[model samples]
Target: MPSEAKSWRWRYRFDGKEKMMSLGEYPKVGLKEARDRLAEARKLWSGGIDPLAERKAVVEAKEAEEREQQRRAESSFELIARDWWARWKEGKSRRHADTVMSRLEADVFARYGHRTRHLRTSSVKLNGS
Candidate 1:
């Protein structure tokens, strides 16, 4: 209990002849939520299911969702770059617009092709001569 007597720790007891379990700790896991989790574990244990494994599955699902969001960001670089060019062209001379378009299509587009399709179409309409 390392002096933090309030940390979530695995606890067990022997009720006469058989072992029983308890979840130790508070707000770190919250009182109500902790009770709910314990109720779930007890029910699952009675049914022969591992609560820890179930919790791990939930965590993995959440991690996958976060990874998907990151993929979208990486894939959106080209889109955002082209959108920036359109907004910038409004304030730039033709020569500046040409320079910006050349740099972006040459560098940014190739690097983020899969995500750049929609952006490329917008760029063509916005910069069409």
Candidate 2:
């Protein structure tokens, strides 16, 4: 026997077109919750807002925020500089690479290691200007 699948859904018209939105599934969203969701959708529709579009906007905003956070985390100056050095140091002498890293640690990393590399202004000031 094929198991029956059940879900809660609501149908409504928006901009003269019919649309359906899923509230949730059986046992998870109960009858009361489904009715509440339907009422909320109806209220939004009456106010000229498309419930589906609103839901999509919220989802997109959340995804964009997550991407921005990940980009910031990956673009820190120390992370980017280390990645560059790993690739650039191939075939270079160990002493030369160590000297370069020592200078970076003493100078650049000390000042901007935790900062993201996409800053618009240089963090270091030249001649106190």
Choose the strongest candidate by lDDT. Answer: 2
Assess each prediction's global lDDT (C-alpha) against the native: 0.66, 0.88
* Residue range 16-108, candidate 2, lDDT tens digits: 999999998998899999999989988988999999999899999999999998888799888899999999899999999999989898988
| lDDT by residue for model 1 (1-129), tens | 476556444443323334334465665677777777678877876676565656678889999999987777665867677677888899689998999899888975675544623356666568651
User: Which 10 consecutive residues of model 2 have the lowest summed lDDT?
Assistant: 120-129
User: Candidate 1's error at 33, in angstroms?
Assistant: 2.8
Question: Which whole-number lDDT from 0 to 100 does residue 50 have in model 1?
Answer: 60
| lDDT, model 2, position 23 | 92
